[model samples]
Target: MKAYILQKDSQSLDNLCLIERPDPVPGPGQLLVRMRAASINYRDQAIVTGGYFGGRVKRDTIPLSDGAGEVVAVGPGVSRFKVGDRVAGTFFLGWVDGPPVGRRTARGAPADGVLAELVVLDEIDAVALPPHLSFEEGACLPCAGLTAWHAVVEACRVRPGDTVLIQGTGGVSLFALQFARASGARVIGISSSDEKLERARRLGLETGINYRRTPEWGDEVQKLTGGRGVDHVIEVGGAGTLARSMQALAFGGRIALIGVLSGHQGDTNPHPLVMKGGSMHGVVVGNRAMFERMNRAIEINGIRPVIDRVFPFAEARAAYEYQQSGALFGKVVIAI
Candidate 1:
């Protein structure tokens, strides 16, 4: 098997070396998958740069958690999946059901991730990809898509006629827009680039605010809602934009804090939270059960994940670099 191995001392993409390794066998209740595609997430970049989750790396690691592949073999007692089944790897392998908290259920840390020719996943940790999605699209579903689904559908419980604000056009934000729109909710997208905002409009976003042009974008959000703030805000910018998100929320509005793309540290006054009686929920990526339910909705609604580009497996480093550029409107993938 050929795998990209990160050298211990080098925290650069140049340190990622494609090397030959012995093929791994499935353990009990595990399934061996021949990977077809893997997608990059913000976490993948942090891991590559040695800045994620307290910068922990016990061994040389293979990067990326979200991938889709065909099952090649199954270990004993793996009755749920058989050879030739097309499945997507679960981002949180330890979390099969219920809500996720802390770092206990995270995937792609010390564990070998999916940037390889083959991977062995616990049978219960993989979800069958929707028959309607391609391997590349399925690769995007596990992390970014599932996170948005969990926040909008499961956590916030956004309803029809509710107005939701999604910041930026990154993978999670774009998925949030698509999912919210499919649920019959109104969507407002915020972006720093007008070109990207136009692209988002083509994707069915009815309103867009260029944050760079409109420094007081929160006020615009309020205006769009006719003096009331939006019902929900997918706060991907975290602390850097938390105050603005606060200003853009209606009374009792919910903000799903999904990422810290903008620097992690900032101060926020408690008065708005108290006065508006709104809530902010920290969303980790979802569990296996949520991923399964999301897939069903995707198949039923015929929603397709927005893929910015696909890179060959050997160009995984280039793929990561492209994602870091912040010019992409959707997920970047590596075809394995």
Candidate 2:
């Protein structure tokens, strides 16, 4: 089997080496997944640069939380999945049906990632991929996709005729836009590029705000909602945008804090949260139960994920570089 290992001694892309390794067999309650594809997330970048967990890794780690594969073999007591089933690994393997314990349960870093030709996953941590999607598309779902589902469906519980404000056209934001739309909610997107906004408009984005032009998008969001504010704000910009996100929410609306793209240090006034009584949910992807339910919805609605590009397995480094560019419209995939 072949796998990419992030060398414990280095933190750059140069440390990510693709090498041959002995094929792994499943243990009790495990399934050996013959990985077909994987996708990159911003967190993966942090892992590659060695900045994710304070830039110090005590041991080598596999890197990537999203992957899809075929079940080639099953270990004893693994009846949940069978050989030949198409499945995707869950982001949080240990957090099966309940709330996550912490980042310790996540795949790809503290745990072995799926950026390899083979992976061993607990049967309970793998979900059957929707029949409507391809391996590459399924590979994009575990992290970015599931996080979006958690924000829209679980945290906010957005309903039809409700308004959702998604920040930027990244993987999570695009998925949130699609999921919200599928639930009959109106979506407003904010991005720095007009070109990206135009692209978002084609994907049923009800309103697009060029944040570079209008720095105070929160005010514009209120104006768009007729001073009532939006029902939900997918806050992916971290502390830098938290203030505006709070300002953009309706009195009883909510914000799902999911990312730190815009830096993690800033001071936000606590007044809006106290006055509006809006909810703030710190989403950490989701549990296996949520993943299963989200797949059912995807299957029923025929929701095809928006994949921006697919790179060959050998070019995984290039794929990661592209994701870091922040210019892509959606998810970047690596087909194994």
Candidate 3:
């Protein structure tokens, strides 16, 4: 088997390398997966370059939470999957249902990841892929896709006629755009690129706010919504944009604080939440139950994940480089 590892104690991509290793065998309640594809997340880059969870790579780690593969073998006591089933691993290995137990449960960072050509996962920690999606598309679901679903759909409770404001054109933002549109909400997408915003328009975006042009893009959002503000804000920009995201929300609206793209902590007026009676909920990628539920919606709505680029398995490092470039509009995938 071949896998990429972020070598122990080093966080720079300079330390990442590919090596051959013995193929892993599935133990009790596990499945041996022949990986078909994997997608890169911002957190993946953070882990590889020492930007995640205090910028420390504690050990050599396989580094992706989003991947899709075919089950080639199943160990004893596994009933959730069978040989040749197409599946993707959950972001949290042990979270099957309900609320999250802790952040330590995540994959890719502080745990062996799915960047390998072959891997073993507990059967319950993986979910069946949507029938219509290609393996590359399925690979985009576990982290970015699930987080968007958890934030916009489940946490914010988006509904028909409601307005949703999604920040940027990264994986989670694009997925939130699709899911919100599928739910009949009026979708407004924020991006720095006019070209990307136009592309988003073709993807069911009702309106586009170029943050560069309108620095207070949230105010622009208000103007677009006729001063009513938006019902939901898929807030992925952390402190740098949360204040604006807060200003963009309608009275009593909800903000799903999902990412720390602009660093984690900063000063902000609490008046936005206080004055509007709005709520901000911290979002982590969700559990298996949410993953399964999101898959059902993906299947029924015929939603296909927007993959910005695909690199061959041998070009895994380049894929990481592209993700770090901050130029990708959607998910960056590796075809294994």
On a 0 to 100 scale, what is the lDDT of residue 209 in model 3?
Answer: 82
Model 2 vs. true fold: TM? 0.97
The digit string of per-residue lDDT tens for model 3 on 1-336 reads 999888987667888889899999999999999999999999888787676775777778888888999999999999989998999999988999988766546778777888899989999899999999999999999999999999988899999999999988999999999999999999998898999999999999989988888899888888888899999999989989989988889999999989888897899887978899999888888989999999999999999999999999999989989987868899999999
Displacement of residue 292 (Cα, Å) in model 1 is 0.7
* Ranked candidates (lDDT, high to low): 3, 2, 1
lDDT of 2 by residue, 64-157 (tens): 8899999999999988989999999999867787777655467887788999999999988899999989999999899999999999999899
Candidate 3: Cα lDDT at 259: 89
**Highest-scoring model, TM-score:** 3
Q: Write one digit per residue (lDDT tens) for candidate 1, span 137-250.
A: 999998999999999999899999999999999999999999999889999989999999999998889899999999889899999889899999999998888899999999
Give the whole-model CA lDDT for all candidates, comma-separated. Answer: 0.90, 0.91, 0.91
Clashing pairs in 2: none
Error of 1 at 117 (Å): 0.5
